[model samples]
Target: MIFGKKKFLAAVGDFEKAAGARDGEAAERAFAQLYQAAEKAGDAEFREAGPRLAALLPSVPQGPRAAVAVVTGACVERGADPSACAPAIFAGARAGFEAAADFCARWAETGGGELPEPDDELTDEIIGRTGEEPAIGWFTLPQWEMACVAMLGHRSVRRESAGTAELLALAERVTEASGHEFKCLTYALRVLDDEPLVVLHRETGTGYVLRMTGIGDNFQLHTLLAGVLIGGQHVPGDAPSAQEVAVCRDAPGQVPTQGSFNLAGPDGAWIFNEGTPSDIPVVDGARLLVLDPPPYRRGWPAGRFFPGMPGDLVLDRVLDEAEAAEWFAKVQPAKG
Candidate 1:
């Protein structure tokens, strides 16, 4: 039978009670049952329950400062320093934002419609939350929002990084100012657009050794770097876009010798190349490298590489589902 809002809310209340009691496993099971029931019912009344369900769970706190606090708590629980996990969490949030965007794009395409304009409800929410809407292109809203949340989660753990602070401020401002309908994707996009670029300065005894750049393009690379730095697996890849493939194929010279990139971050740096044949460094992480041919070579097999701070960094660390489950298990309320 279909549930009314009252029934749904009551179910959520029951789950919340279970969660509060630290019966995490039981709560999760209850939540799963509700979710499946709602899905099976498939009515508009039940549909609104989705976000409510999320709200009942231990959310990654809303707002900037709160978000950082949550991440810090998680890191502390894991026997890892908050600083160590900050960047990884940030990267993970960014990956999530990107995933949301990809989902939006696919949704639009599959639905065979132009991007839907934000409804008054969403708009009013944004305006109430942020003073103004961050300027975001229509096509990029979903990706932008997904990335913003991931970054926000990261900032919640690591208190340093002026860039994180600035972005958070911007997110708040946007939330307060805009009357645009508040789609999570759109909200995230606005946050990213409002975020200031982060510049990493290396101080050598004399001056600064190398002017290390902040997170670069390729969201995937940032995702990889964050995973390794946090000692976790990288986020799973989304289906490659035709544009991405074309960009890879048509772009310039052959991929230089394997180890030409520098893949390091606040944690440390490492060198990778053909002779050493080490994994790609953070500098060249997520880059399409052409191997076996010099610049402008006729035809050489191009390889997709993800570089990182070298030292036997294994892909399994971040990408493993089991690890994610473990992490979740620790944070989630205890099983009933």
Candidate 2:
């Protein structure tokens, strides 16, 4: 709203005062205002004070959650370019938080060999791109670091239990709001659920197994981008042995225990089992033990479903009530 020198200084003062008091929420609130003022500041004003503002963000009293969301939302509210401020925000944040540490372990790859510093040509090219966020992701490491930090920060603080569709929707919202298509980060929040994710929604628990396929969805990104977002992961649809699958039904007659039938090879009973007009007639009291990751953590980024990473998704059992509860006991639910 055309914030001038006086308003900007006042907002900064408020943030410092709140952080000094160890009032994280209040500090974040003040930081939100400061970020807004930074956006509204004129070209000259931003050039003059942006560096100073950026220098201060690392030490700001970041709250328990949504610190990145708060900053992005402020940029969205003012219709400011998120890239304009991302560098400073991230440089100050990467080492300051634990969630960023977790994210780095998974995503901060030294890929394609060492990345050279972005020269003016590169910066200008980024600024000229139709969709890329300038000086942010895919540019400098600091901006990339910032993007990841914010993403994890949002996850740590997010209070919503989202499915695949809902997470995609939020990604769209963040893009519309901040003019930044944070594809990797936004999608990761929903797909990964919690980092080291381990939970299930009843709707998706069944759908997850039902939709589990080996690979090759027309080599498309949209079809299974969620899978890849959690980690550079893959889930094998290879079924356990017949001996492994032979179920010990608890009851003699109880609506053929709803489950995913895994077969021993690429072509077998499992595929035909899902075929039309009943081949292997189902009666009552059958058991199914589908071992896969929780639905939220099932996506394999970049279509990597085989030759996967450690801890991608293994032994995630979709057993009957008694067995499911037992499996849930061994894994500790993730703590913020």
Number of the top-ranking candidate, with lDDT as the measure = 2
Which tens-of-lDDT digit does each residue in 261-288 have in candidate 1?
1322223332222212212222222311
Using TM-score as the measure, which candidate wins? 2
| Model 2 residue pairs with clashes | 227-299, 227-300, 227-301, 228-300, 228-301, 234-305
Query: Model 2, which residues run further than 4 Å from truth?
Result: 1-5, 35-39, 62-336
In candidate 2, what are the lDDT values of residues 1-336, reduced to their tens digit? 325465665676776678668787887777678766765555544343444444455555333222443444243223333344444443333332222222222222322232224222344543343223322332332343334334333322232322324334544543443344544444333323212212222222321211222221111112222223222223333332222112110111112122222211111123221221112122122212222232232222222211110112222333465544543343233221
Clashes of 2: 6
Number of clashes recorded per candidate? 48, 6
lDDT of each: 0.31, 0.34
TM-score of 2: 0.24
